[model samples]
Target: MMERKLVFGVAVGVAVGACVVAAVVVGRRVKSRSKWKRVVRVLEEFEVAGDTPVRRLRQVVDAMAVEMHAGLASEGGSKLKMLLTYVDNLPNGSEKGTFYALDLGGTNFRVLRVHLGGQRSLSLEHDVERQPIPEHLMTGTSEDLFDFIASSLKDFVEKADDPDQLVARRKELGFTFSFPVKHASASSGVLIKWTKGFSIEDMVGQDAAESLQQAIDRIGLDMRVSVLINDTLGTLAVGHYQDPDTVAAVIIGTGTNACYLERTDAIIKCQGLLTTSGSMVINMEWGNFWTSHLPRTTYDIDLDVDSPNPNEQGFEKMISGMYLGDIVRRVILRISQESDVLGPASTRLLMPFILRTPSMAAMHEDSSPDLTEVARTLEDILEITDTPLKVRKLVVKICDIVTRRAARLAAAGIVGILKKIGRDGSNGIAGGRSRTDIKLRRTVAIEGSLYTSYTMFREYLHEALVEILGEETAPHVILKATEDGSGIGAALLAASYSS
Candidate 1:
């Protein structure tokens, strides 16, 4: 009886032990499942976040439109200090002279000299020399960089000796310094900030004219930076000097900006200063404009997050040359990474930003037989060798979306400018008194590489303008490409100041 009782107790204990072991195993499984569920939720959120580049791009565009309108209709008046700079000092009728223009745009520097006659014809006596900025100098000290430029100018000057003497006074030069500057006068301006992939350490507070002059002087060259101006200001000056009706200038390239003539009286910001002609040139660093009415995408947001300056220049980040190709790359990369549409692995583009603006321009203009242009451009830019036709088509679609979005938004900005100029309306400032009855005839003198190089950009921009302004006034509003307007325009500004 005792033996049987002991066996019964042992069986009960064994049963209890088995129950404990089973409970522990079930609990562990349940905990693991809960953890996995949390992880899946986070992953889903990420996927959603990454899929909204279009929305983000639109948001940025809308912001830019708002800022553009504000800058155009800036405080004192809807006028952007739109003053016609007089070229009083240009060689009088029937005189001949050689003028030099140094254009310091992003990515490259240009040195050009023109031979002009009193009969209103100009010829390229010498071809312009273009030199890319060395990798070291771009990120080097200001003095080292300037010294390099000075040396280049010295070389260019040495090349200027003529076999046949042309009688003229000291040569005058126009320097197109494409950067943000505070112009105290036409002869000089202070560099406020450096943009355009340039980050030289010593150039922030230096006078741009003085820097160029010092470089020239160091080379023992005898020429003056007679016209120190930004490219937009140069465009306006050159446009107005060429034709008085040309009142505004806009540059849409790797970056985007606008400048126009404005009345001195309208600028309440500078109450104490006196302008002899009651006007000055205003540079609308309009890239920072932000508002609604634009489209944004997931790729755009990703770009903004990765950009150097986040939450600023939201509009430019969306549409400029520097970012458009990058956006396309990001979108393709995302689609390749997540979706089964790409078939297999992503193209191993060794460089992420290699798909530059020019490549984008090339892809956009590609119309070769069998769409080989598009295929070749994609391969060249992304280094994707032997890409299948399917992938090529996908890339082309992405390019289309990006380009169309940019063109459409760019049109909106132009329309906003026209609206501000009152070409579409009769809401005249001062009830259409004081100034001439301009009567809604406005001209936009455009300058920049993208404007010049892109195939259908101009047409699409015009289409958008027509959509906004209607077909009637679209013809009345002119958008013409002003070649080298900035260089000559700087000299014109010098003349205006000297006068």
Candidate 2:
């Protein structure tokens, strides 16, 4: 009897322990659910479902067109720069002979040589070399930097052939200087400002083409900068070479900008400018474009406020490849703070730019049954662990939301350009012109890693265009991918403008 009583006591103890464990588990789950609900509330503010309908997008399009007009009217008139590219003539596939191109857009520069066969056939040979600009040189005298570039070019030219090509002829080079410049002519422009982390003080208010030419002369290199063009103009030139119908070009890599052919008469600020082609390409510095129509959440506002250039490039902050990953990190950081579902808030999440766009793309494109890639990224980037399947799915949902919003906004911007150019509706850009007179086919040349490498982003942009334009109008517009056309296009420009 005593033994039976002891066994009953043991059984009661075991049952009490089990109940205690069950109660603790339930309490933890309740707490987690509360946190999750808070995260959902935060996400709801960023929802683009209701904010970006067709009607709202049309308003954005209209705003963009108005801003373009304002910008073209005067300097510093609107958020859009609307700088004139001075490219009156695009490549017509008749460019012949050998030409060279020098691209100085970033820390690394590219030297390209093209042998034009005429009739749209050509062979290209190129060498990409990286030379880190010394920290002092970036802020030093303009001559110092240009001299460095010229010396590098001399080295590249010396290695062109076995001493024969070096002395063959004075090579004409198309210089793609990707910066804000006020063009005096096709081969001359004054540097307006330095961007992309460059801060040369003396470079401003100086002739960019002449500086490079002087540098080349100092180095004794027999190269003439025949045409000075921006990267967007170069890309457009390549597109025009391939297809005459191509009227616009966009670059969506680390940053976003576009250029398109504009009637010379529309350039009200430059009344005296003349070109034989009767049209000019205007570089729409679209990154700075902002409007109340853009759907902005607290996250986007915070990003802008905290950026190095606050309240600048607001559109780029929302759309470009450079900032997308950081935006995702901000969202995840908020989620981690609100919920222990992802364990604890990570120190890595506090760091800026810890999660790059490529990694974000990988996580968004993860197709594993368990979402192992998302898990891995969380672990690797944020040091978060033990995330449940549902939480992992939530991360994916956040990515989709951010990516979709960016893409749709980009589509709206593009349509705005179309509306300005008289391609969006049946009516011409003049507002009252007959629809029957307008051609149905229009092509836009696009370049950059985001459009070409990120499959989902491309799809989202395309889908948004369809939604905005509808089935009938969308079919008439095409966004053609032009790979590495910037270099080739510059070479073509050199060939076209060679004296």
Best TM-score goes to which candidate?
A: 2
| Residue runs of model 1 more than 4 Å from their true location after superposition | 1-96, 106-108, 118-127, 131-169, 195-202, 215-221, 347-351, 368-370, 378-394, 425-440, 486-488, 491-499
Residue 494 lDDT in candidate 2: 92
Candidate 2 matches the true fold with a TM-score of 0.92
Q: What is the per-residue lDDT of model 2 for residues 251-339, given as tens digits with 9 covering 90 to 100?
A: 88889999999888888888877889889999998999999988887788888888999999988998899999998898888877776
Candidate 2 wrongly placed segments (more than 4 Å): 1-22, 48-51, 121-136, 162-169, 437-439
The pairs that clash in candidate 2 are none
Instruction: Compute each candidate's TM-score over C-alphas.
Output: 0.73, 0.92
Q: On residues 1-499, what C-alpha lDDT tens digit does candidate 1 reach at each position?
A: 9999999999999999999999999897887566445434433443454332434433433444344344434453322232222222322223345666788867778776665553433322434778888978878887777777778866876676674423334556788888777776666778888887889868898888888888887877766777776787777765665556665688888888776655555444555546665556667665665554445556677788888888777768766888888877776666555543334554654345768877776776666645687777755555455656655665666676677667667766665554444443333322333233334567778887767778676666676667655566667778878767655655444444432
Top lDDT: which candidate number? 2
